[model samples]
Target: MNDEKFLKGKVALITGAGSGFGREMAKCFASKGADLVINDINMEGLEETRDIILKDHKVEIFLAKADISNSEEVNNMAKKVSEKFDNVFLLVNNAGIDSGLYASLKSKEDSYDKVMAVNVKGAWNVTKAFFRQMKRQRQFEPIRGKIINIASCAGTENGINPFFGVYSASKATLIAFTKLWALELGPSDITVNAISPGVFLTPLYKNDPKVIRLLLEARGVKLPIDKIGEAKWVADIALFLASPTANYITGQNLILDGGMTISINKL
Candidate 1:
């Protein structure tokens, strides 16, 4: 029954904090008393996120504009974070991009590269930069800190999708990373976990009506959860894993799809 603000005094760094799960997670963590360091390419969106969070929590917040795919920028961001925050207890590698460049497109490789650059490489750069710092420092109990990676169930279950090869591959890689990093970082007590979100009504889904419709149709009649998931759902999961309660959890990917992934296939 330890309840004196789970995230109080902890510092959390989240990429893609300008929109979707990243933005919502920022607010959730702040509400629980965690200081924030958020990164995103959209300055306006980032500002909006900051404004919304400032309304309730009185915690330190740092907003940085940078593309996660840029190694230099990510490294620099990590350095700057180290300068400002004394205790960096959580890292959420949530900055990702989904290019609708299906395999049918002529320049599909180009699209795949772009998606991989952001979805996969970006995650790698940010994690490597931040984890290096965590590995050096000695702080909080059970686990020094936590890293929650946002992956997709598409990687594991729906590899047969018509044109989502690249996206699927990237997610598969993330899943593998979760397993590998858990083993590598277990010694230092730094837990690494992944969340494979099935269908969510975040900004990503908001962008394309056709895609949304397709997901709805694919789900069939009487959807599992009336509507798609909100960013808050993913955020809550991320916050839980980062909290002290999930200290014993690591190397596992929790699927959050409103029960979408567990359904029996019917065609």
Candidate 2:
């Protein structure tokens, strides 16, 4: 609703923008006057997200239903984005999925591949595609670009999470990629960072029945956040990281766990 233009005249490409953090980030960026290219595999969800943002924010938005795991589709999405925006100032690799609870002994190859494809490989493809634009900008423009990746606290801690081992590992891989890319892009004035969210109640989580059971059984109860983290929190952080305000920061992971990770010892 805030029409103040921090990102005026900028362009952003966000993956997995159909729901949760991605959807919220799209709205936030639109509110700040940024044109958006939102990608997701969920066509219905993508349409709803597009409609919502289009209502209040008149910024140009393009939505595509592409699975990030498919390299060809991903590359095509990147091409479409580039054609629409010419150059992207903000690239957010935020599409991911939960593989449910699988024990180490019960982990299947399909499970590993599915999780890795979206969480790790998907991030890589998007980053690589956008980096080409960043590199190109390095020669002509100011090259002040940002890459914000979404990670999770599970990457750093292992507790009673069921079937989340693969998911955690995928997030850890993304964090690692963020660090390495930050190093590679910093000299060009491009910033790369990651965000690790705790328990945020979103459609992405609520839709997974098995994940809800795992949470209830593992912790026995939910924390007292009243409501889980809103998608807006993640969006706000993304805006900060992409803005000139965070120009000096790069290769850092901001854990937005809402005290959950901090209270692990007491629990």
Candidate 3:
């Protein structure tokens, strides 16, 4: 465990923080002593996350219930964050949706739109609203900001999975933006990166061993670790990117696929 309070005075804004990676990151950041601005469309989940964090950490946690897909809502939430904190040092665009197991021909257009709206445009909306503050902070801070976008292994051309073309494309878009923003923001000392995780035992998997086994067997997939990933694993990477440790890294997509992506047979 990192006992160093590296982010003691910094403020972090994380979207889709109600559960999964977002929730896990919130807990980790708070443990590192960073104040939090957590957002989610689901109020119950948001409150649950807040409760979990408050149990062990005393950092300030502000909850915002907003849909990241809605530009107006995102802007409004960002306004609240700006009002509460003078500057946001970290931004995590972790809110994303997956279009469940439907063939390309059978998938609904609305499904595609929903996935794109939250996964792609949602990330854009949050980043644009908070970037201004990050740029302004550069005038006085050594490192202005850090942005971590939660992408997926499915986004890579060679990492594509069956029946998830829309979700994959949406994540690919985010990956592109991660690199583009790193280029555009690097001059100002704002590092941007993406974490592309493969199979994780998140709520999506329901934490059922039978379901996981069935899915892996059905897809003929094999992982070197021989198990699904944990949300904490991804959160740990986000912490590294947001910390001063990754000062020189930028515009990179860090794949967390448990060696699945490197397998020729899986590819």
**What TM-score, computed on C-alpha atoms, does each candidate reach?**
0.91, 0.89, 0.95
Kindly report the root-mean-square deviation of model 1 from the true structure over all alpha carbons.
2.3
- Supply every candidate's count of residue pairs whose N, Cα or C atoms clash at under 3 angstroms: 0, 3, 0
| Whole-model lDDT per candidate | 0.82, 0.81, 0.88
Candidate 1 lDDT, 1-267, residue by residue in tens: 156578887889999999989999999898888999999999999999999999887998999888899999988888888888868889898988775635434436778788889988999898888887777558687778789999987666643243455777788888888888899998988999999887677778775656766865764623467566677889989988988888999999998876655552443
**Model 2 lDDT at residue 153:** 76
Question: Candidate 3 — which pairs collide?
Answer: none
Reference-based TM-score, model 3? 0.95
- Residue pairs with colliding backbones in model 2 are 101-162, 101-163, 102-163
Better of 1 and 3 by lDDT: 3
Better of 1 and 2 by TM-score: 1
- lDDT per residue as tens, model 2, 55-123: 998888888779898889988988887777766788999999977767645778988899999999999
Q: How do all the candidates rank in terms of lDDT, highest first?
A: 3, 1, 2
